[model samples]
Target: MTPEPTLAALLARLDRVEAHQAVADLMSSYINACDLAKDIDRIVEHFTPDAVWEGVGRNIEFGTWQGREAIAANFRGVQERQPFTYHYLTNQEIRVADDALSATGRWLCFEPSTIREGTLPVWIGLAYDNTFVRDGDQWFISHLAVDTLFATPYDKGWGVEMFTPVTAPKEPSHA
Candidate 1:
């Protein structure tokens, strides 16, 4: 017969389970903030003070943002370009550290976005790799990196093209 785990072992297992769920909840909250276009302050609360947000692969054009202030600015820019979007996250996997002070996670995101008011509708496929830190009892994002798999027009599938040209928003004319 298999031996039962000690109380200490059971407690440790519970801790890990809680940590995993906390990390997942944090990601969901972050995504919700983005989708809702919440205040920059609220959005940045999900990250550590010195957190880094960057883009890789086809998303390299997004550059990188370091620290909470920069991250907030980046999101502001995103809000301007992507006025409306629905982000769906799936295939999420999170692993908590043995000490339960940190965790790493990955997720696949599928987004349908309307760019620049009603100018264009696009479909975006992306992958996210995130690192999280536990402070006191709250978890914060330490680092977030995103890679774009595809960003194509809604009428055209990825099979037709991987990315659609995204131009900068035009300035209002005063005549």
Candidate 2:
């Protein structure tokens, strides 16, 4: 009979790889949360309690919130003010360090935030640079840094392509 791989051995093997799937999962949550554009709490569940989220749009926010609550509030502001636009994430890369518990990922994002009046209000090129940590058996976003690579005013008439709605995942029943 073959013996099972030891935890030490498994971790060592993982360290040699970039753990791209883990990074992809992180971005999946990001993309899913962005797509909802309604249920505001998804943003809170996506982040850890002390997560640091920043971007070109964080400041001059509609209002301020702190800790995980801050992220939820941010989502609220986002859904309330910004018209729904599809965000496309692509060209992602993850670099896993020798420490299996830590990793970093980079991805390019294109999205337009528009207003109800159909005015494209803001255009942004965002880079999601991440620091990850596993919470028990599950992975959660420990620290997220959003670098706005570029931003410009979206013309009033400009419209971006959007994917049609499918059955989106529901948030956990418990808050």
Candidate 3:
């Protein structure tokens, strides 16, 4: 015979589920604001006051921005460079803490952009490792690390060279 769950256990399970869903929704909202909504204010609202946003590697613009103002500037730069952008996220992995106060996620992104005042469209492949914090029942992005794997014109796909990291060893690995 199985025993029913205690009220405390049931509430704890619910809290975890709610936190996970909230974090997922937060991610979707930020991405939609960046592309579909194209609302800078909405994008800014997703981050914590002391959030940090950083980009690594050669595939995309690289910068380390801290605080809400700096993060807003980064998004503004994106808007300036691309009049219209579409971002697709896949392979998402999200983990919420047992206490339901924080979470982390990893995602792969394919972004295509219409360059401002230009006819050419560019595409980029990126990986996002993000962290979220729960503040008074609301979740906000606390850190965003974006690693761009490849960035090229729509007509030109990534080649072998794109797959090779700039800092690779001189000799091939045996493994």
TM-score of each: 0.90, 0.68, 0.84
Tell how far residue 26 is off in model 2, in angstroms. 2.0
- Candidate 1, residues 1-175, lDDT tens digits: the string is 9999999989988988999999999999999988875667888999999998877665434667889888887777778788888889999999999888999999999999977554889998889999999998899999999987888888887889678866442332111
Candidate 1: which stretches are off by over 4 Å? 116-118, 167-175
Every candidate's CA RMSD: 5.0, 8.9, 7.6
* Model 2 quality (TM-score): 0.68
Global CA lDDT of candidate 3, please? 0.78
Which consecutive 10 residues in model 3 have the weakest lDDT in total? 166-175
Candidate 1 positional error at 32, Å? 0.4
lDDT of each: 0.84, 0.59, 0.78
For residues 1-175, what per-residue lDDT tens digits would candidate 3 score against the true structure?
A: 8999999999988999999889888999999999888888899799998888877665544667788777776666667666777889999899999999999999999987666434557676889999999999899999999998876666765762344222212222111
Q: Tell me the lDDT of model 1 at 154.
A: 88
The residue-level lDDT of candidate 3 at 157 comes to 56
Residue-wise C-alpha lDDT for candidate 2, range 1-175, written one tens digit per residue = 9999999988788654635576578678767777764556765676678776554233221222336866665565556556565678888888766765667777888877564333446565667777777665455676676655544556422244222111111331112
What's the TM for model 1? 0.90
Query: Top lDDT: which candidate number?
Result: 1
Question: Candidate 2, after superposition: displacement of residue 64 in Å?
Answer: 8.9
